[model samples]
Target: MQRIRAFRARSTPDRPAPLRRAAAPAVAALALLLPATLSGCAAFGGERSGIVVTTNILGDITRSVVGDEADVTVLMQPNANPHSFGVSAQQAAELEEAELLVYNGLGLEEGVLRNVEAAEQAGTPSLEVAAGIDPLDFAEGESAGQPDPHFWTDPVRTGEAVDLIADAIVEQVGGIDEDRVRASADEYRGEVEALHAEAEERFAALPEERRKLVTDHHVFGYLADRYGFEVIGAVVPSGTTLASPSSADLKSLSDAVRDAGVPAVFADSAQPDRLTRVMAEEADLEIEVVPLFTESLTGEDGDAPTYLDMARYNTGAIADALAE
Candidate 1:
């Protein structure tokens, strides 16, 4: 189990200096000071139960592996942008009380990262899922050279994540049936492997030219790599949706769209489609804007309630849109 000093301002060697410095001093300081106090309090320690996951995607995966064995709490809500979603005070306190902390730690959760660090400072065992998997760097755009955090787009990589979570639960989380957790992971892994095979066949049916992808942001690097598609460009030109595209960036992307003759541009379902629509309109060509569940999952009544459902839905949506 990975452990850190109890409530100290520790350096994050994996992240850039700018991102490391982005941690709110006030929040970090409070977290640093309160872990001891939080731990010393009988109520806080007594309430520490189950696993706490950062993103809904990982939370769903964790639930699949954990089943009814342990209580799993997900911080990010349905249809919420992972880059901007935040936790409330009660939720923040729960971070310190988590039996294990799991997060997609390639800077995906910009809003809740400090809270994750706070939990780590409080001596909670953590699994940075993306770091454990072999991550690919953003090939181009504003976040070029940085590790791409959107690994969930690839089902094979997602299977690896399931294994990691199961291993963490058995090792870090106490009083759980390790055998049952392992069995659940194996079952889920089989499902993900099937999804990978399905995606391969689905993408293979498309013409080479149709395999090119344009999106609202630089989110499909892993998917493109996995399925042998080219990423033409993104409207935002950055990894996170929080970043805006300059006029020059928009014009450049629009020109690329026109040059490539891409018929459709995919936008995240959680975010507005205005930028994609603008890029499509500016291209002076017939371009369709398709919505995809790229970053977050949805409610039970929605299209993408689970990770598997999200992947299948996206695979079909991309195939159908590009094929047209």
Candidate 2:
């Protein structure tokens, strides 16, 4: 039997401060003031109304589909972990007032899901992108049977999401030309298809033995299933970044890494690579730690500023790490 020793949880960069009882009155005052201020801005043409997206990846996709018809406001910052990123009170209010709210559902956005639910209850039309796709279940451990929310890893599935998001934008958002939205979506779909083809070609070039992945977390299941790669194990055994890895989990993964002779362990660009480094050292192997844009997009000057760029960058990184 493996001994499971709990590791201390690391603080996420975007973790918000705790609400205090004494500050409740000030918070309530700000809550009341924000709407009126936002309303005034809208009246003065300072605020652009359109789609409000919870995650940066979905925000980029929505931007591609909408194409300046309406402004798209993304709540999460570039390279922030979606599972832990929280929105501001003003952003939450914007979610309520936006023409449509788009989120990567299936419990991926743990911190912001409550705001999404509130927006829905307030009668703002919303779309859960993962709800339209055939989601994969957790194949093992404590989160078994829950739907995997990282469907965007699969380009074909992401293309499906493009169509679904386009349709929703056309139907729900007023003042946008439906024909233009459809046309934009069609063009983007072709791009997605091309991306998928490129990825397939790159992945096919790798030898069968090299198509194995060990990662910081279980984030690549969809990509592995789509590209013929095997995810032997992850440093964190669960889908979400919020889950902590036990010492036994790390030891087991290290043993697997040694047995499989994996050349590299991949970590998300938005996350700390400490666990993966430790795992590699513990395995007593000369394994490299590669960073990939697995979850969120980055700043405009960054490598993965868009959905297409993110996929291309990730695919290339994976191939280079494994093929070498």
Candidate 3:
């Protein structure tokens, strides 16, 4: 439920290309190209509405659309690293009952891929949100445009994802309140659009040179694409947070950060800051860890409990911090 309050991404007049200094670092550049892990199933919220999402990010949005109509049992648990997630027997059993299974396709949930494959065999319909969004092409020799599944990083794209995902849910799941669900989706979509507009307005005010983003990984590709920002590189040099980073990748990213004159490195607040800290410490640069929302959403008590809330919180954070 943690919310990002420091960083804002907005479209601007001048956009700069990423600095191409060296060949691909030795890290598994292809790994970051892969999507997150997946889950088998679960006894979610003590009631089974037959709708289950693979990740908390999708589950949160689904809950908003389904409301009391369905009880969403999220497969992945809180604080459980989804990149290297493991499924359980109970979770596997839940998939058998799912009429609609929502997930971010495009190789996210790699570990969960096997489970999703199994779920498909069990006759459960899996919906990948990244199915329609414009994808990013990987660097030459990187994982060939496998299409990053982290579209939720960009609020506009996430809004699009929600609209599409909600429709699939209504059409696939039986007895859902169509008027309620569609209206909820439209209302949420309007909020997301507003958040994007506000972010653009706020972030566009930053100095041109400050439009660079350095992070633990290239998760912000969608955000950078939505607004005008250059992704300098990442500490992991891969896609999923489940992978490990090498000392060489650290030095390289730190060098890139200093070279790019970026004031900060973006990190996910939902996860610990050990790696960003290490990267900052090693880089010996004035790097601030701009904690943000990624992968999972917050609970009802959390700051970003829903997709729209996450976008608004992140937009405000990025706008305020970058404007500084």
lDDT string, candidate 3, 30-72, tens digits: 2223221211222233333478788877887778777777668
Worst 10 residues of 3 by lDDT: 2-11
Q: Write the per-residue lDDT of candidate 1 for residues 34-113, one digit (tens) a residue.
A: 31112111113345677889999999999999999999999999999999999999998888888778889878999998
Best by TM-score: 1
Q: How accurate is candidate 2 locally (lDDT)?
A: 0.79
Query: In model 2, which residue pairs have backbone atoms overlapping below 3 Å?
Result: none
TM for every model, in the order presented, reads 0.88, 0.84, 0.79
Clashing pairs in 1: none
Candidate 3 wrongly placed segments (more than 4 Å): 1-49, 138-144
Off by over 4 Å in 2: 1-49
Q: Highest lDDT, which number?
A: 1
